[model samples]
Target: MKGLPAGLPSLREVLSRHGLDARKSLGQHFLLDPVLLGRIVAQAGDLDGRHVVEVGPGPGGLTRALLATSAETVTAIEIDSRAVLAIEELRQAVNGAEGDRLRLIEDDAMRLDLASLVPEPRQIVANLPYNVGTPLLIGWLRQAASWERLTLMFQMEVAERIAAAPGADAYGRLAVLAQWTCRADLLMRIPPGAFLPPPKVFSAVVGLIPHPVQPPPDLFRSMERLTAAAFGQRRKMLRGSLKSVGGEALLDRAGIDPQRRAETLSVEEFDRLAQLL
Candidate 1:
C-alpha cells in the first residue's frame, strides 16, 4: 500500500495498458490482491536487512508487496520483455529510500546464479512460473548454503511433493532433495480465484530453511542420481529400479532391503544409499 506512488494504476489497468495477458507458456498467473500479496510475503518471515530475490514477477503484484517491507533490497528477474516494461512504472514510482530498494533484471532465472546477485542473508521469495518452478527449486536446493530461506509458491500438487513424507504419494525426488538439504513446510494454500487469470488447479506456498550443516557437494549429486533411478520406475522394487545405478549390489552395501519400493524409502534411507555411491 505504502510502497507504490499515490494514484498509480492498478495491476489490471497496468496490464491492460501494456497489452499483457497471462501467458500459459510462461506459467504466468498474476495475483492482484494487495492483502493476499502481503500475506504471501509474510511467509518469508522477517525481511529486515535481508536481500530478497524474486523470479517471474509477471505484473509485480508480489514485488510491490515485498517493497512495502523492511527488506534491504528486492531484485526482480523477468524473462519476458513485456513484463519488464509493465513494471517499469512501479520501479520509477519509488523515490528516496524506497527508490534504491527495487532493482529490475531482465533475464532468465534458470541460467542466472542467484547467489551472485547479493551477499549472504539472501532469500528467494516468488510466485515461480509453474513450468520451471521445480527445476528452479532444485537448483536452489543444491546451493542451499547460499540462502537464508526460500519462500515459494507452486501448484498445490508440486508443493505437496516438496514437503511430502517418505510414504506419501507426492513424495519423490523433489521431497528427497528438498528435505535432505533443508527443512520444508507447507505454509499456505491458495485457491484458483486468487489470480487475475486463474489457473485450473490450486496453489500452495512452501517455506524452506536450509540446514546449517549439509552433505558435501558430491554426496548431494549422488543423492540426485539415486533418487532419479529409484523413482524412475516407482512401481518396481529397488533392486529392479536401481539396476542401472548399482542394482542389488548397491542395496546390499547400504543395508537396505532389495524388495523395498522407491516411495517406501525415507530421506535418511535415501541418504544412506547415496553415501554408498
Candidate 2:
C-alpha cells in the first residue's frame, strides 16, 4: 500500500514515461488534474463494495481516483491498446487491496454488452471519450434496470441536454428518454484546460440514478420514433414533423396540442404520446 495519500505521480509524468500521447482519432483527452479526478469519483458516492465500469480510461487518471475510493472492483473498458498498457502501470501504483481490485478490459466500449459484464450493485463512473458518449449512454439506458447508478462526464452541451426539462432549448429526445427512466443531475463543470490536450468544449459530470421501475414496455421505442420525427425538423410543428406516425391526429389522441414544438414537450407528454401510438 502507498499509504493514505496514495503518492501517485502526476499524469503528465506517467504519460511521458509510458510514451503515451492522446490520439485525436480516438477522441482521447487525458484528464491530468488530481483534484478534478477525485471530484469525479466522489460524485459516484459510497462505492465501497460496489463494482464500477469505466469507459475510455485513457492514461488512467480517473482510474487511479476510482481505486482510491471504497469500490470493491473496477472494470475499465479501454479501446486503445496503448491505454491498456498505461492502465496496467496505474494498477501497480495503487498496490495492495486496491491494486488487486482492478480489471482492465481492452475493447471498444460501444461493442461491449455492459449489462452482462458486471453483476448487480454496479455503477458506471467515467470521463468518457466524446465521440461515443451519447450512443454508449443510450445502450446503457436500454438496460437501465441492471445497473445502480451512472456518474459520467460529457461535453457541457450534452450534459445539459440529458438534464434538460420541458420547454428548454436543450430538451429533446435525450431529455425525454433520460428523464423518463432516471433521475439526472449535473454534478460539476470542468474547464477544457483541465485535460491533457484540452478539448475545445467544456465538460461536466452528470449523475443518473436509474428508476427502480421502468415505464411501459414500449415507451422507449415510441419516444425514439416520436423524437426522431419531431426534432428531425425542429422548426416544424409536431403536426407536420410527426405526420409519418399520425401527425396531428396522434397528438389529439394523446391529449397534446399538435401546434407544440418538440422542445416544449415534457417527458410525461412524450410518454403519453408514446403510449397512444
lDDT (0 to 1) per candidate: 0.91, 0.84
Best by TM-score: 1
Q: Which residue pairs of candidate 2 clash?
A: none
* Per-residue lDDT over 105-136 for candidate 2, one digit per residue giving the tens place of the 0 to 100 score: 88898888987887778999988888888998
TM-score for each candidate, following the candidate numbering = 0.96, 0.93
For candidate 2, the C-alpha RMSD (Å) to the true structure equals 2.0
Clashes of each: 0, 0
TM-score of 1: 0.96
lDDT of 1 by residue, 17-47 (tens): 8888988999999999999999999999999
Give stretches of model 1 more than 4 Å off. Answer: 1-4, 95-99
